[model samples]
Target: MDWQTTKKDFKRYLEFERNLSGNSVHAYLNDVRKLEVYCEDLNLEIEKLTAQHIQHFLLWINEFALSPFTQARLLSGLKTFFNFLQIEYDLTANPCELIETPRLTRKMPSVLNIEEIDSLINAIDLSKPEGMRNKAIIEVLYGCGLRVSELINLKISNLFLDVEFIKVEGKGNKERLIPVGQQAIKYLKIYMDDIRVHQSIKSGKEDFVFLNRRGSPLSRVMVFIIVKDLAQKIGLQKEISPHTFRHSFASHLVEGGADLRAVQDMLGHESITTTEIYTHIDKDYLQSVITQFHPRS
Candidate 1:
């Protein structure tokens, strides 16, 4: 089959059957496209490609000096594509079955200390209409440990502020209730009661907890720009993003002796192993845990 039709089929498979996000589906398709390009340049039909062709494509891409993490991601996508071909198209043999992902050196994400977080928040221009909104955004981002997409899509109906919990819609549209802190609750209330209520919300946008000046839902890029602008304003240059608050939240909670499972639940991580990074980030906390709970101690 031609790569074009195969790609369309793969897209549908990922969207409907696998239930991946749009960004995730595009990423997997992009990886497949790289292999398609290599095959096209050498005039090799994709259906006839074997493991050697796949290997050759990997080697060719390696010339671009991609990071190890990126290399691993690309390999993962290729493996998924061939598996889809085998299952859906009934291919006799999967080409990328035996390929190994490149070993990646995991780097610890940068965490914002409480003081740095306070400084960033305090620097907001409260005189402006969006100032309280920005404060509330930072509070929820750090307090709830939410992803940017979740923050942007946060609905008023899903919020249980009086009960101190907010239902977050995470990856794959999975919903989880995260406990909100008192500070987040206070600022979120102010933004909603005072600021957002005054806005001329457009039709169908009223339920969104956060809205722009035009009364529409905020975009992910707008959130990034907001965080970046705040970072620049405070002169804190640690390469922060909306996710830095998430990492900071987990790290601080781990340091404060919160249960790992509880933190994982709050962050909506599917695997406990994904939440294990907090243990590494807080070395003293790790030591304390060992000392307090370990049989060897």
Candidate 2:
């Protein structure tokens, strides 16, 4: 079968059987496309892609400037795709089975201190119509450690402010209930009642918690733009994005001596290895403890 046909089948398998999100499906497909690009670079035919071909591909990827973490994820996606093709289409035996992933070194992510977070929050212009909505968005982003997509998809119905919780649909279509902070709840209520309520919401976006000026669901890019603009407004020196809130959420908890397992559960991380990055962030706080308590101090 043509690789295109096989690729379409793989996509269907991911969506129907694996129940992968569109973003995840696209990422997996992109990994496969990398192999195609490599083949074209070498002036080789797609049908000629075999285990030996994949071995060369892996070696080529290693030579690139990409990080081992990103390379490993791409390799994992390739492994899944080939396995799916082998089982369903009876293609040439899976070519990526025996390949090894590069050793990944976990790096600590940057976090905003409480004061920095406060500065960013206060920087929002409250006089404008979108200002209240923006304030609520920032509060919820940091308060819940939400992914940009999660924040955009957040529905009014899923809010449980009375119970101090909110339902978040995370990666892989997994849903989890996270505790809501009092400050976030306060702003969210104000925006809902005073701002979002007055907006002329389009039919489809009525349930969406955050909306654009036209009352449509906010895009992920808009979230990024808002964060970037805020960072600039506050003269924040650190490179930050929507994901920085997630990093800070975990880092702050770890620094406060929260259990690693509990932080992992709240973040909805599938593996403890992914959660271990925050433990590294706590090392600085650990040093402070040592300095304050040690007889050497």
Candidate 3:
């Protein structure tokens, strides 16, 4: 099959069969496109590819000095694509079967201390109409440990505020109930009642919990800008993003003796290993505590 046709089928598989998010589907497709370009340069066909060609592609990408993490991700995407070809097209053998992924060092995420988090939130100018909305956004982000994608797509209909829980659609369109802190619930109500109710919401956007002043849903970049502005206002030295609040949320929970599995559930992580990163954060916290409090020289 032509590379373009194969890509279309792969996109459908990623979107429908695998139920990946739009961003994830886009990233995987981009990875395949890179390989497609490499193949085209050599006049190679899809079915004609073998492990040596795939290795050559990896070596070729290496010439561009892509980061190991990115290299690993590209290899993973190709592996997944080849696996799909094996299943759907009855390919005799997957070309990427013997490929080894590049090793990556997992960088620990930056986390905000309770004081820093408070400082960031307290820096908001509440006189503006959007102030309360921004407050609610930060609260929900930290309080629920939501990914920015989940935060932006959060729906008002999913908010069971009376019960102090909100349902969010996580990766792969999986839904989960996350308990909302009273602080988050309070700010959410204020934003909804005071700020959101007065907006001229665009048609088809009414159910969205967060919105721009124009009444459309907040874009992901807008959320990042919000977090960055807050950090600057507080003169915080650490560079961070909306995801940092999520890391802080989990780190704080683990430091307070919350179970790892529960943290995984709240964060909507598919695997416990993904959540275990916080345990490393927890260990760092312990080290600091001992360094500060221990009497030994």
Candidate 4:
């Protein structure tokens, strides 16, 4: 198949079969474009591309100093593309099968301490019309460790604050119930009663929990900007955003001796291994504890 036609089919497969959103579909397509560029540089047609070609392209990307995260995503896209080809076009062989994805090192996420979180939250001016809704946004982001996409798509119908749980549709359209903290429920109630109740919500966004100034749904970028502005207002030196709160939420739970499996369920992590990355053990703290308590000493 020609690159253009194959790409078009890939889009349909991603949307219909994979059920990915527009942005996610575009991201996968962008990864394919990288392969197309590599093929062009080598003067090879799309059909002539082999597993070895894909491997070389990956090596070239690493040689060009692409970050491991980006490399990993591109590799994932390639794998998906080849899988689709095998299923649809009777192309039995997959190129990405033997391509080893780069190992991603888990870095500890930047998190605000309790005092810093309070300062950031208090910095929001409640005098504005969107103030109450913004308050709810941050409260839920930190309180539930929700992804930005999940936060924006949160529906009023899904909130079960009385039971301390909220239903979230995460990656691969998988639904999971996450516990909602009490403080978040308090802010949510206030926002729903005061600001969200009075707004003349647009037709399509009526069920959406967080609304823009025009009574519509808030975009993911808008949420990022809100977090950034709050960080600046509080003079937080560490770079912070909405997801930082989530990382902090998971990290804090792990650090406080919460059960790893329970934390995994709360964070909606697909695997226990993924949740294990959030367990940040301090070497120096361990040494101090041992020095103070060991009977041998």
Each model's lDDT comes to 0.92, 0.88, 0.94, 0.86
Best candidate, lDDT: 3
* lDDT of candidate model 4 versus the reference: 0.86
When sorted by lDDT, best at the front, the candidate numbers are 3, 1, 2, 4
Candidate 1 Cα outliers beyond 4 Å, as residue runs: 284-297
Give the CA lDDT, 0 to 100, for residue 226 in model 4: 94
Model 1 error, position 256 (Å): 1.5
lDDT of 2 at 155: 92
lDDT of 4 by residue, 204-246 (tens): 7899888887888899999999999998998889998889988
Q: List the residue pairs that clash in candidate 2.
A: none
**Deviation (Å) of 83 in candidate 4:** 2.7
How far off is residue 179 in model 1, in Å? 0.9
The most accurate candidate by TM-score is 3
TM-score preference between candidates 2 and 3, better one: 3
The model with the greater TM-score, 1 or 2, is: 1
| Candidate number that wins on lDDT, 3 or 4 | 3
Q: Which stretches of candidate 2 lie over 4 Å from their true place?
A: 37-50, 60-65, 90-93, 288-297
Cα lDDT of candidate 3 equals: 0.94
Residue lDDT tens for model 2, 1-297: 566887898889999899889989999999988887887788886545677888888789878877888889998998898788778867677777788888876666778989999999899999999998999998898888888889999999999999999999998899999888999999999999998888898987789999999999999999999999999998999999988998898898888888999888889999998898887778877898899999997
